[model samples]
Every structure is written in structure tokens, then in C-alpha cells.
Target: MIKVKGLTRAYGSFIAVDDISFECRPGTVTGFLGPNGAGKTTTMRVMVGLTPATHGDVTIGGLHYRDIPNPGRHVGVLLDASAQHAGRTGREVLEIGARTMGLPGVRVDEMLDLVSLDGREAKRRVRNYSLGMRQRLGIAHALLGDPSVLILDEPANGLDPAGIRWMRGLLKGYADQGGTVFLSSHLLHEVEQIADEMILIGNGRIVARGTRDELLRDATGGVFTTLVTALDNHQLAEALTERGLVVHQAGEGLRVTAEPVDVGRIAADKQIVLTDLRAGHEGGLEDLFLELTAETQRDVLPNDMSADEVRA
Candidate 1:
């Protein structure tokens, strides 16, 4: 397990990470999520000893990373995929890692196969490899030691859809076999699909952290948003509003703040013909994320700005 207690990192007057505490347990995939420059990378760097923490501590299995013997054999990390030696081939890179860990050379071949890098491709120089291929090679190197814990930052950044799916399966299987996986990403959908727990950060502090259902439950406060449409959407909207439920025009339907049954009962009492009604929690995570991090999000236009002003 990975434990971070009151972890903080500051550069002179600028604080990069601020008193954040969390845990990444074994046999689970924990996603660290945030917008760019939200201190996710700095926290990861402090956890692995690349940067000094101004306060608090981080430990893996009750020991600091620097204190662990041959830490790579116990904790696998791939913070930057492009940090590999450009002069070396992919195979050569893994070979060096395996040799440093005192593993047999065949272990490198196994990892290459595991990551779907064919023998021909493995012989290609790192400089010639595309970003996607570099990510694959980096993953191969991270898993080469078969460590119990893996820490990866934005592993899906350059991957195609199929490659992303493959990565999800691979990490899921690894956690299933009792490995701890701590992944970081700015993409909501990618983390939502695979993370067992999520930590959302903004402005150097944690805004929220929990399982998907738990976070959504807290955000909605037990009141679910329902989407409904009827033959007369205007009538349905008026009826819902009359019932003191918040209603908004949403894509040819009315988004109401009430249960489906409540909306249905109102529609029936109003003699309205309903066409569609369903719980609208599918986008709850995205909505909650945007709401919580609205101030930290980049390049957002002012709501009061006119279209002509924006064009100007």
C-alpha cells in the first residue's frame, strides 16, 4: 500500500502541493485526477523522492522509497515515457533495467511480448518510435520487474482507442492479481472507466476523493437529476416547474431535479404524453468535476461575453 500523509511541496513562495493526504491500497487502481498545473505531477514526484516535500511524508509498505532496497523490484514507476535514452533501442533499454534489477535477460523478452512490442519493433531506436510506441515501451519497462506496486502518470495520453482498452485490461488484471496501481490523468472518461477510487485536485488541494458512486452520491446529496421528454415538452416543463422542481431545457428534453417516479406522476396528473424518462446520472462525474474545478480550468470564456465579443 502507498500512504501519503499531509504531503506538501513548495518552490520558494509558490506552493505546488498543499497538505494532501491519501492512500493507494494494494489490489486496487487509484486514479489521481486534475486539470493541468493542478499539482498532480508534483505530488507524484515527491512520492517517489524526485522532489523534496516541504511537509509530511510518503511511504510504500511502511517504508520510504529511498529506504527500500532495489526499489524498482517492489515499486514500478513510469512518470515520463519520453525520458528514455534516445540513442538506445527499446530492447536495449529494458535489458538495462532488467540487468540492474539482476533479472535474467529473458525477462526483457517477456515484457516486450506483454506490451505487444514485436521483436522487430523492439530493435528500433527510441528516437524513431512514435509517442504511442514510446508509451508502450515505457509500460513494458515498468512491468518488467513484476513489482507489487505501479505508479504511472497519464499512461493513456498518446494511445489510440484500442491501445487504451488494452492498457485498461492490463492494469485491471494486474490489480486483480494483488498489485497496487496508482494512475494519474487529466481525462475524466479514461479514469472513470478503470479506477476503483478517484482523487480530484485543484489549486494544490484535494477537492474530492472517493469511489464513483460515493462521489456522485455526495455531489447530488441523494437527489438525482432526471431527464424526461414528452409530446408537449413545454407543458411538461411548466408542470415540473409548478411542482417546485428545478427544470432546464436540455436537448429537446427537460432536465428536472427529481426522481423519475415523481416526474412521471406529475406528467400523468397533467394528462401529458411522455416519450422518454430516465435517470441522468451517466454524466454525473463529468458535471461534478467541472463544477468543482471551474475556477482552475483553462481558457474558459466569461459567461456574460457576447458571441461577437468572443469572435473579436
Candidate 2:
């Protein structure tokens, strides 16, 4: 288990991470999510003892990282995939890492296979590798010590579709095997699919933390949305209102808050020439996250859309 209390980091007059607290249980994948400058990297660094905290404590199994006996043996961290020697092969990097931690070279080879980079490419210099391959090398190195807790920052940054799928399964498998996985990522869809719980931070402070459904419920305020495209938006809106459904006009259609099945049945009964009728699938995580973490202040994650575009 990992526990953080009053965790904070400051640089001069700027607060990067502020009094954030959360506990990650054993045997679960917990996603740490936030906008770009929400201090995720800083927090991770503090957790691993790479950076000292300003005014808080972070512990692994009731012991601080630095106080733990052989911290590397209990915590495997993959913070920067780019922090590798370009001249060394992927296999060589892990071998060195393992040796530094008093682990055998065979453990390095095992990690290479575990990350699916055991083939000929593992022997090639890291300088010749692509972004995705480099990420795999980093994972392999992190797994060298056989730690029970894995802390990764943006593990999916450079992965292709197949690699991403493989990584998802691997992380899930680790949790199933009673390992605790704490990872940070910008991919909301992937987190929704894989994370058992999440901690959301904004402007250097934790704004929300809970199961995916719990966050969704809080963000939506229990309002439901449905899309109804009919030949007659006017008639549809009127009928829905008459039936005590909160209805409004959208683009070229009507959006209703009535039960989806009931709305469909109503349309069918009126013979309303429906063009497109569907219910919203719990507003996308991307949308809810954007709304919860307003873009007015600090740096946000590099979304595909610009701030102005997101606002529009």
C-alpha cells in the first residue's frame, strides 16, 4: 500500500504540488490524472525519493521510501523513458540497472521478455530505437528488481495500438497477481477502461479521486442526456415536454432527458420520422475532465484541442 499525507512541493514562490493526500490499496491499478502542470511528475518524484517534499510525507507499506530497506526492491519506477544511454543496447541498460540493485543479469533478460522486447531488437543500441521501443526498454529496466509496486508516468505515451493493448493487459495482470500499480497518463479512455480508481489533480492540488463511475456521477450532477434526431424537432420537443421530460433543441435535433427506451417508444407511437435516436453513454471522460479542470490557470495536459477550441 502507498499512503501520502500533506504531500507538497514548492519551487521558490511557486507551489507545484500542494497538500495532496490519498491511499492506494494493494492489488489494484490506480490512475493518477491531471492537466499537464498539475504536478504529477513532481508528486511521483517525491514518492520515489528523487525529490524531497516541501511539507508532507509519502510512504510505501507504512515506511517512507528513503527509510525502507532497499527501496528499489519494493518500488519499481519508470518516470522518464528517455533517461537512457543512447550508446547502450536495451538489454545492456537493464543489465546495468539490475547489477546496481544487486540483481542478476538473468533477471534483466527476463524483464526484456516480460515487456515483449526479447527479440533481436533488444540487442540493438537504444539510439537506433523508436519512441515506442524505448518505452519498452524503460519498462523492462523497471521490472528488473521484481518490485511489488510499479509507478509509471505516461507508460502509453509512444505506444502503437497493439503495444498499448499489450501494456494494458500486462498492467492488469500485475494487479491480478497482487501487485499495486500507480500510473499517470493523459489518456482518459484508456484510464476509464483499465483503472480501478483515479486521483484527479488540477493546479497542483487534488480536485477529485474515486472510482470512474463515482467521478462521473459527481461531474454530471445526475443529469442524463439523449440525442433525438427527428424530421420534426418542434413536435418532438413539445411531446417530450408534455410527457414531463426536460427537452431542448440541439443543432438540428432535440435532446431529451427522458428515459431512452421510453423516448424511443414515444417516438415510435407518434410515427415521428426519426433520423437518429440514441442515448448518451455517460458523457465522455475527456469532456468531464475538461469541465472539472478549468483552463483558466496553470498548464493543462496537451490535449488534441487548444484551450480556445475546447472552450468553443
Candidate 3:
């Protein structure tokens, strides 16, 4: 298990991570999500000892990462897929890692196969490998030790849809077999699909953390928004307001803070002809993510802005 308590990282006057605390337990995948520069990478680096924490602590299995013997054998990490030696072949990369961990040579073949990097592909120089292939090679190296805990950053960045699906299943199976997986990504849908729990961060602090359903429940506050359109839109709106439901004009319909069934019942009682009625969570987790991180998200330039103004 990974435990972080009041973890904070500072660079002079600028604070990168601020007093954040969370846990990644065994047999579960914890997704650390945030917009760019929200401190997700800094926190992960501190956890693995690449960066020093200005305050607080992080421990893996009750021991700091630096204190662990041959930490890679216990905690597999792939912070940057491109950080591997560019002069070596993909096979050479895993061979070095396996040798450092005192694993047999056959372990290299196993990992290459596990990540689906064929013998021919493995022999290719790291510099010649595409971003997607580099990612695969990096994953192969991370799993080469068969560690109990894996920490990856944006593992799906260069993967295609099929590769992403493969990775999702691979991590799911790893956690199912009692390993801990702590990965960070900005890909909302992929994380929503595979993460057992999620930690959302913005402006160097955690905004929310919980299971997908739990976060959605908290965001909606037990009141789901329903979109409805009726032949007599004015009558339907009045009836919904009379029933104590908050209603808003949405296009040619009404958006209400009530369930579809409840809205249907209200329309039925008012003898209104309904044209449409459905829950308004079509955006799913993406909506909640954007809402919580709105302040941190970068503003798009106005379309009318001149090129010189944009550069300026």
C-alpha cells in the first residue's frame, strides 16, 4: 500500500503540491488526475524520492522508498517513457533492468511478450521506436520485476484505442492479483473506466477523491438534472416550478433538478404532452472534472484575436 500524509513540495516561494493526503491500497488502482501543472507529477515524484517534499511524508508498505532495498523489485515505476537510454535497443533496456534486479535472462523475453513487443521490435534501437512503441517498452520494463506496486504516469498517452484497452485490462488483472496500481492521467474516460478510486487535484490541492459513483453523487448532491421537452412547454415549466423543482430554460426544453420519472409524473399530472425526457449526465465524469477544475483550466484565445496579439 502507498500512503501520503500532508505531502507538500515547494520551489522557493512557489508551492507545487500542498498538504495533500491519500492512500493507494493493495488490490486497487488509484488514479491521480489533474489538469496540466496541477502538481500531479510533482506529488508522484516526491512519492518515489525523485523530488524532496517541503513538508509531510510518503511511505510504501510502512517504509520510505529510499529505505527500501532494491526498491524496483518491490515498487515498479515508469515516470517517463522516453527517459530510457536512446542508444540501446528495447531488449537491451529490459536486460539492464532485469540484470540489476538479479533476474534471469529469460525474464526479458517474458516481459517483451507480456507487452507484445515482438523479438524484431525488441531489437530495434530505443531512438527509432515511435512514442507508442516507447510506451510499450517502458511498460515492459516496469513489469519486468513483477513488483507488488506499480506507479505509472500517463501510460496511455501514446497508445491507440486497442493499446489503451489492453493496458486497462492488464492493470485490472494486476490489481485483481493483489498488486497496487497508482497511475496518473488526464484521460478522463479511461480512468473512469478502470480506476477503482480517483483523486482529483487542482491548484496544488485535492478538490475531490472517491469512487466514480461517489464523486458523481457528491457533485449532483442527490439531485440529478433531467432534460425535458413538452408540447406545452410553458405549462410544463410552471407545473415543475409549482412542484418545487428548480427549472431552467434549456434550448426548446426545460432543465430540471429532478429525476426523469419525477418530471414525467409532473408532466402527466399537468396533462402536458411530453416530447422528450432524459437524464443530463451524458458528459459523465468529464462534466464533473471540468466543473471542479474550471479555475485551473487554460482559457482559449478569442477567435477574433490577431496573430500579433496572440503572440504577445
Best by TM-score: 1
lDDT (tens digit, per residue) of candidate 2 on 1-312: 999999989999999998999999889999998878878999999999999999999999899888988767888889998888999998888878887899977787788878888669989999999989999998887777778999999999899999999999989998999999999976777876789999988888887888986776676676667888888888888777878998877888887875478888888888787888875645646666777677533556566878788778
The sequence of per-residue lDDT tens digits that candidate 1 reaches over residues 135-249 is 9999998898889999999999789999999999999999999999999999998998899999999989999999987888877787788999999999999998998999999
Ranking by lDDT: 1, 3, 2
Against the reference, the lDDT scores of all candidates come to 0.93, 0.85, 0.91
Model 3 clash tally, residue pairs: 0
Misplaced by over 4 Å in model 3 are: 224-280, 299-312
Please provide TM-scores, in order, for all candidate models, with all chains considered together: 0.84, 0.79, 0.81
Per lDDT, the best of the predicted structures is 1
C-alpha lDDT (0 to 100) for residue 134 of candidate 2: 92
1-312 per-residue lDDT for model 3 (tens digits) = 999999989999998999999999999999999898899899989989999999999999999999999888999998999999999999999999999999999999999998999989999999999999999999998898889999999999899889999999999999999999999998788898889999999989999999987887777776688999999889998999998999999999989998789999888887899989987764757778888887788864566997799789
Whole-model lDDT, candidate 1?
0.93
How many pairs of residues collide in model 2?
2
The TM-score that candidate 3 achieves is: 0.81
Model 3: how far residue 190 lies from native, Å: 1.2
